[model samples]
Target: MRWPRQVMSLLVVLALLVGPPVALLTVVGPPITGWPTSGQLRAWVQQPLTEQTLTAALTIGAWLIWLMLAYTVALRVLVRLRSTSALLRRLPLPTPLQATASGMAGAAVFGITTNTAAAAPEHSPQPLAAGTTTLHDDAGPGGGESHTIADADGISVADGWIPRDVAMQVSAAASLVWLRRRRNYRPGLTPGDQPGSDLAPLPRTVASVQAALADNPAPPVAPSSYAITRLHDVLPASGIALTGEGALSVGRGLLVTTLLTTQSRPTASLIISNAALISLLGPAARRLIQRLPLTIVESLDEATHHGHPAERRQHTNGPRQAEDTPGVSGHPAVVILDEKDCDGGDLTHLADLSMGTAIIVLGRWPAGPTWHAASSGHLYDPHDLTVPKLRLCVLDHVAAADLLAVITPGEPALGATAAPVEASEPVRPNPRLPRQSTRYRSHLSAADTPRQRLHLRVLGDPQLLIDGEPLTVRRSAGLQILVYLAAVHPTGADAAQLTDAIWPGLPHHALTGRLYTALSDLRTSIRDACGLHVIDHADDRYRLNPAQLAVDLWHLNAALRHATTAITPSAEVWQAVVDAYPADFAEGRAWPWLDPIRETIRRRIIDVCAASAAAEPDPDRALSLLQAGIRIDPYNAALQERANRLLHVLNDDNTDTGIGSPYRR
Candidate 1:
């Protein structure tokens, strides 16, 4: 009963195979003498065979062999039927009644044609006459012809099937083999089937798209010097944030970064109702379409045409295939519906049915019919473990630039181009805002005069000292650029020098956009934090305004320079210099450019300490300064000797010669 369908199929095949043979045996065997009757056959099978009854045993063995052959045929038919059923599922089929009627009519027509052909069939073969060639459809290269024609329908039929009777026979044999051996047909047992795997999250698919976009070559234009350090704070993971006028660029950059950094790139369907928004995306968006595996369609008509036209037309009156609909196919990981006119109907039909698909709605602010206190503008699913509904991200100017860079890869983002600086003009205050301008005056003085001065501390950890308060820069490139400009001083460094210092290994041309961004970020940070713009540019070189602020490193060097001209520099002056330079220049930072400056500061400190020690009258005090110099520059041989001499003067117990002097180079 458990395998009744299989059993019945097997029986039908067996009946066909065995019925004719058994009928012939029953009819013909009776005429022949010594034919085994049912009673005699049963008695022979029941008893053990003896030498005297060997003839009856042989006859009974032959009949058993025939039955075995019949059973084998039956099993082959069952296997063939199973295969047919599987194939039928993949094919488009007519209604049951229609198919049955067609099959019956075709069978009747085939029978008539076969009978008519048989009645006219007798024909003699003729040899080809000289100078004439016969073209046979099945002729071999050897000129031999095949007598039988292959079925025309057979050519159209898919292969991989055994005849019903043959398949049945094979199945029966397979079953017999399995039962008899009680072991696997192959060397090892078949492995257990694993459960079906779940589809990957849609975000993964989007990320892949984002990556492809990022890898592409950018457009011809270059990005402007626009920077915002706190982009990440405004746009967090898994939700949308609104950005105002100034933050647009930042928002756009974050969007692109988010798209690329997100773990998954699921299939996404973008529905945009506003044509203007699409146009505004420009080349970058166009490039993204070309790069990502995205399908863009506006209306239902376009969706209907996704699959075969004939299939769509045939099912126009009924429910269409899920695949025929854009997002429903599940090929896309997410659906982006940007329709200005998107309503409850669209959401109910498209987004709701989309279910597992992530739906990102754009432009339309108000909720449709689906919006409820519980729905929260997003249709919730019990299975959805991600953020609710669509994440609304605002793409600002900077964000757009980032998106452009990603989508185009090598292209400059929109609005990134810098205005051409006039060749004749040197770097000066902005003409748009004169020194007397109220806003400019306001920035200069919090009250009557500017409350904040340009305060830079680069002796230790580099920081922007604004009004005696240290302000840390979030962007490392900006900080590095600022430090380099400060180190070079009034003369500053050209674009080439800055490029070499900032990005040593990158190609010069590729650094333009990045350099612009760094400069912009530095300027922005300085303006916002210190309420001053100390950086000035001229002849393609950059420098910091010394008049506007003071730097510790600059002061240390200035003091040292003055000390050389003085008749006799006081100990206090030397001490001040030593104390002013607390740590190595650009300490805690690891940059090749910082190495020389850091070493220079170290050497200056050692010299100052050594000179101060030599001038001191007290032997113990002189030894202390010498020891300080030795500690500052352990590799300085001259400083080491000074320390040794001081130790001798002090008459220290450990003043013995060459006892592993700490200052030995």
Candidate 2:
């Protein structure tokens, strides 16, 4: 049933459309005496030649079958839809909570009730079960070590407090605050990773989670979501790896140079955990929510300790970043301590550190990079595949530890009491990524000689650069910012000049550091290879050492040189120009410099195509060249319109039969 996946959708549609029509056809008809009226009031029940009876019986069966089929098809279609959350959100608010709230509201509405016991949800602040963690936590692992029990039954403080059910929904909404689609990947399962099995290497927390789902004996339920809500029982493992970019061979599709390596402009990653509910909400719901201007930020500033009533009660009013952390941090921020005593009252201490905030989560960690984690509170060794750099970020995503858990998955998470990491000690750099800092993240690898010049490839729209080896970058804008400097006659373009060139409307101060980071990457890639200053700022000139680098633009310069001045044109010259054209100038970065290169190469490609078609008369080759040229200049009326109209001239000239030459086949 290798149906293009599209056919499954089509089949469902067909069943829905055809089944109802068949039901209607069976019902709408001229009746032949109408089923014989139960054999004339039970007198002629033995009669066999009754057309009306048979017809009516067939109709009834047909309608029933049609209804069943339609119902089945509709169900299948709904299940396959990308968003399905809205349909199932009809569950009633909790009965217990609803009853309690109704009772309280009734007292106010009717004015006939005695003083009520403090309403529920006013002060009943329970803790997560032992050995569990979820994103809702404001401080690091609370209870310091373990939460103390305070009989919370019948606990209340306010006259009119929110219902428990409403509170639960509000808490759940907090989880959805910084929602983003998370990519789940496991390393060993990737083709060609078997030999590395049992390495016990550390990956990012997100990667750990991905590996968990991948290696799980049970089938995965869904992709791209936060794990199950019951955090204590079934914590979805996250992996650890350094953050950056890599080219996926993805069967045959490769994005080599489109500058995708440097993540420049990032799109919003929305995670719809309840797909069914999200589907029902649709774009309209998203717009409405965006318009709401919800200020539901939970502050982490000035939050010192955990599990203290004052700390917890007053905790909601802290720094905006703290409250905002849960929304965007991409995982739960939990603080772990030894105990809830005043000394480590994870709550009070949490308050001081918070500086008047709850939680501020504004990083692009996908439930974050990984650390050593437990499956069922036991040491769970993970297979090694996640690149090492992104791991620490992963663990920090979920665990609210005093210090980050930076070890592999099986290793025990280091607690706050562990020896302090010396500020002077050099950090062990990320293994998955080369040690390149933001200082030069955006410059091009300045190759010192023609031999070191990297090759350029066009996978689709954008072309990627490979200087002896592929380069990895974290931000696309950084890559673009780097490439412009790289592509420029690298005598480094001034910061002001480059900014205006790349982003005409953007202010200098806002993008200067970011652009500087991208150049640093280019600088590092160049340093690692050809050992040259890719971009240097001196005497107000942003210059690239041409000795250290070569680009498609320069190659095109050579091709044009060979084509325009050669007394007699050769196939090699035309081929050189054709080879120089890259599908995309910058893979992921959208900047102004790319536009000129795109159009320039585009016209040059057309010139080569037309020249090749004229110089060589093979129809297949000519057609291919022309078609390639046409792709870029589809609306060009001059070349195509003139050539097609001069078809007779082209047919008659066999030696130079291009699109409209005077030559015949």
Candidate 3:
């Protein structure tokens, strides 16, 4: 066994066995390039025997063997390299046996490689690329404020909105289909919530306010970001609170925002969150948002649907009725909202889609850096901007409860706030007043003051004011009929007059029932009238005890008489006149058959002004009174001429005996 002899022996042995299979692989593997790929090969092995893969492979193998045989001697040398031992063993056997063995072996190797691939784990799946975010994908039911949201493309709409955010993908796809065929819908919210709407409906939202907690809101966003509005119930939670106007400033790093169901009036509030409260100070900011003809983007799909077509059309660009405003946010405030600037949903969606899911308009965004507007309709481009990450807050119910006190103000809640007492004179309690237990309470605010004060907050129409505020009343006809009684208090109107005033449209018995309800509701809504009863109610009439309540008209009459009787009136007399007339006495407020009473008060005010002009000690003071009367009744030629004549006479040192003079007239 010399080295040369060993090499020689090994080559001859290797050539005989390895040569053939190496040759077979070279011949077979290349042609299969145009055939099944590695992935396809793997799938073939998993199928039943009759599948195309098994049949195709067998046919290809036989064809290769025939071609090899056609060049038998030329191929035999190539096969010698693949498997020397097997090739050697088959070469000596019958030719049919050798060919069959070679083909079978090649087919087996191909199948083995493919089957191994089939068993391996799946190949890496590519990550999703960008530019595909959409509103249809992002918004859906239960798609409100959430712990985490995917929003690379503003409003990642693909995630179908639901209580849980798992179906986003299917939702995204479905939204595309739905959006093409339908209009987006934003629910409407009235500016002032009515007395009882949400009470009976089962809540649809998962209770929120967790979003306002520490470490609860989504991580703070970057500067100059947008924040969307969100929906919340009257749950017991109030997030961060900033009070006063200066508390909202850009320098202090706060955003100016507001919420409102009513359009012109926004509740005072500021959003402390991940959003830019963009203020339009110059042409730049204006250019971005103000492309008006005062454009409004109302969803008109309702127009293309059923129901009263006329009733559904919105006349006002924003909310026409205060009660019908989409007063969407938690603690609603006054805000200048641009509907076109925002997305499809109302205020709530505006919160969720922007910086952090919170916004406020009226209350005040804690005063931030201030800027002066050089011109009207100024706008600012946000790119040249920076601000601290707004700390978002979700106000819990406690804060809402406190704010509620301010929004709805009262000593005894300007309307129906008290329960009634027993006997009209005895003033027995009605037992329905929120917390009062005393059987009888004073009608005058405190211990028997000479005058009574009434504060009203009118919710229906912005009509007249006895004081410079809204007038209050119960929704009852009989109780309101008492207004006429008091308007003529001290010299009270007769009972037959009272019956005709209240029961003009009622059956006789209806008067009793209506009166009872009116009296009961009024006692609950008005100031206390201790030991105050309808005395002399037996024969179609009733009168309030004159001492029970201080009547405005009574006070006015007293002031008038005092002024008229005093000659050479002092400043004190003028002060009495000023104090008597607080504001325009109850302007547009009235109930059934109460027009005459209203007219009487209206006339009295005019008369009192006329008398005061004549009674003032200083000619200038008299001129001022005459001028005020003229302003109140611009069309009154007599008042206008009288005022002019008075001023002219005063300027002339009262020497003129002009016929048109206020004194002569």
lDDT of 3 by residue, 1-665 (tens): 49999799768766755565566566654335465678865766665465565655765786566556547645766686665775454322323544676588679878889757655548633322221111112112212112222322221111111111211221222222222211111112231331221111111111111111111222323222222133222100211222332222311211111221111233222322112223312223223223211122233122112112123225334534433333322333212322222334234333332222222232222222222211111112122344222222122222222112212211111112211111112212221222222444445545645443342212123222333543344343433455545553323345445544443322244345445555555555444332333332322335554433344555566665666578766657756765566554444443323222333343345555666666566777777776666555444445566677776666466455443434443
Model 2: per-residue lDDT, tens digit, 382-456?
A: 344442211001111122111112211122322212111111121122213233445544444435233545443
For each candidate, what is the lDDT? 0.45, 0.36, 0.35
Of candidate 3, the 10-residue stretch with the lowest lDDT total is: 201-210
Better of 2 and 3 by TM-score: 2
RMSD of 3: 35.3
After TM-score superposition, what is the CA distance of residue 324 in candidate 3 from its true location, in Å? Answer: 41
Task: State the displacement of the C-alpha of residue 635, model 1, in Å, after optimal TM-score superposition.
Answer: 4.0
Off by over 4 Å in 2: 1-467, 486-491, 521-532, 582-584, 587-589, 611-625, 646-665
Ranking by TM-score: 1, 2, 3
Question: Could you tell me which 10 consecutive residues in candidate 2 have the lowest summed lDDT?
Answer: 250-259
lDDT at position 36, candidate 2:
52
